[model samples]
Target: MKESVSYAPSRADFTGSPAVAASSASDGPSVKSLVAVTLGNGLEIYDFAVYSFFSVIIGHLFFPASNDYVSLLLAVATFGVGFIMRPLGSMVLGNYADRHGRKAAMTLIMGLMSLGVLMVAFAPTYKDVGIFAPIVLIAGRLLQGFSAGGEVGAATTWLMEAGGHSRRGVRVSWQMTSQGGAALLGAAMGAGLSHLLSDQQLYDWGWRVPFIFGLLIMPVGLYIRRQLPETHSTTAASTVANPALTLWREHRRALVLGILLVMKGTTTFYIIVYYMPAYMVNTLHMPASISYWISLTAALLTLLIPFWGGRLADRLPKRKPILIGCAIVSFLLIWPIFATILYGVPLGYTIALIAVDQILANISAVAMFLLVLETFPKAVRACGMAMVYAVGVSLFGGFAQFNVTWLLKVTNAPMAPAWYLMFCSVVSLAALVAWRERHHDE
Candidate 1:
């Protein structure tokens, strides 16, 4: 099973790499350089998500509200603030990458996030600092948001920019795996932290541990990133490719289309990944440890998401499988997904159910970027991608939990998320129909 899951696709196997002119002497990344980019991606996602797993605890400490839902709502809203900042950073960083170089932007974004996490780790709460407590937390999250908005856009730009034409699919596929792994790590750390502390202690200061830990990881990632040479050569020849000025002129439509597709993904992602664990705790009476354990086990079991869909794209017609995967997630997941939630499920059943949902979503997730790589032409791809993807995530993905909670409260449905996902599926289907295949290589 592990062999099948971790099957490393060779360069000879991937014929989907983007075009470089015959006379152009473009230098693609070495295998080692690709690994660094992908690892950096994984670390960034882990650092970003660490805040969410500790949401309840952090909310209590920083926001200090009496109501459970209110505190959580505040923390989640604060998380949303990061999302709001993302698109702006995309404009700034995407342009910066386009103008300066992907490497410089990547380095700068990492440094910003490292400082943000460091601040959060040692931050004083409402009890200690009054209004300023939450203020600083928000500021740190905003910095994280800015970095995140730029980091992936920059890293992805580097990865896609640096790959060989024959194997862009497979090479970029390896680049995608880090996100799932990082998410799994964040869940594991949250669970481990839960185990380490008494409930009172967790409420007191234990929640801050994950923030500190995430800050510490930045240096390790920085060290790994140091090995890879700059993906974009910082030369005078590409001076016309400044991202801020050019993204609008060169990549506008690609950016717009990207938003629609990514919006579908962001909506579904919050349903299955972000909010599901909290739902388990609230509706099913699962302990924090159990929720963490189940989610982690599920993440571990289906960890090869990038490769699974990526290999299919490498060999088969990329469009059908990609579209089908989206349709399946949009359509098949809602009923059973929420049905299991409503049922008074035991631990075993809950774990199985969550694992299945992860599998369904994972099946189509990497196609999100695969499609992006294909749609946008090379020079402006980074800015185009960042703009559309970030906005889609912000408007649709960022507001997911708050929206559903409000809907559930208003409509009184245990399966409100199912309805929401169904709607997103409808949107994804529309996107699939509208999206043309960009198999210029074919």
Candidate 2:
């Protein structure tokens, strides 16, 4: 008779003792784990930022048109196309992460992101392949959208769970910090390339350099992510069941509120930070290099402020800082800040205003992410966060630049983006207030 095989959970299969898990999680993540997870996030953001900063040049190469404005609009539209795939990516990958292990999901998405970056990096321009060029570009952007859809949820959850309940605010802050770093790096690259290359040279070939550089970093990101410890091990068995349905049935309220809250962050980020350089160049007629540098400065401030905001979230009521940040954005600063940029203020003044705007934005972002991290249980945390964030970004963040451009063109109002930002802030503030009250009752 053949010996019967028996299956048993291994040590790695177990989520760790409750006491041990709690102790380790609250104590904060080791530098190794933090760096490993965040590196992938940075890579993802770097790819997106590179695309945004170079959209004008890319427009000429991929979607040449008789009219310059139309060509640029097409390129921006292509950029938004990637966002369209985000919700679907979120559903599939988010569900996978919730069902499988965070480590496995994270590793897989990094590889997917790498493939997308490679597609864009190597795609032939319209001159080389005619219609196929734009096709290739759109395909790559869709792949990236899919990969990114699930990235934030998996990464943020990993950081939060690893950080423990107590220090989750500080721990998850790295998610935004990594993004800010990517923005800074992307801006610096654009600025350097703009300075070194003639306009024709940049349009012809220089734009592809950043995409290639992003591909080179993929292996490093993958290797680092593979070494990360799993945080959702506690839900290993339970997660095998469908999490998406569970999330909708049980956490629908949280999901809706989460999306609303995320709208403000995504809009503010895309508009103020990512879109600033383009706005300066296209609308304000600033030198591309100077615009890139100004954006780099704001990105640097954005990177620094989050750590402080995270620390404050740890010490104070998370909602207070968030509310204050929203108030400042909605009621006081948005109009004047945009006015400064629109009216052709001195470069130093514009940069200073941008820095202050980013600081307030970062504070609200840190508080919001921390709140979301704490709201969901581990079993469906990754899926829940991914779905909400992806949807919010798809609707608001993805189209931010497109909307701003359209608004400016149709209305011929320089303050169009500012009004949009203020509107989003007000909506988000209402959602935050509701969320705070709901959690208080619970």
Cα lDDT over the full model 1: 0.67
| Model 1 stretches with alpha carbons more than 4 Å out | 1-35, 66-69, 199-205, 233-245, 283-294, 343-357, 439-442
TM-score versus the correct structure, for each prediction: 0.84, 0.86
Worst ten-residue run, lDDT, model 1? 17-26
At residue 44, candidate 1 shows an lDDT of 57
**Top candidate (TM-score):** 2
RMSD (Å) per prediction: 6.2, 8.4
lDDT of each: 0.67, 0.76
Please give the RMSD of candidate 2 to the true structure. Answer: 8.4
lDDT of 1 by residue, 1-442 (tens): 0001122444433443322211122335554455556655576567656787788888888887779889988987787788878888888887777667777777777788788777778888888989998999889879878777776677776766565543444455555566667778887787788888899988777887777776776786676666666656556665455665675676566566668777666786666666777766776566755656555654564356555565566555454456666576548756775776577555676567557666656656656676775566545566666777778878888888778878878988878878887887787677766776573221
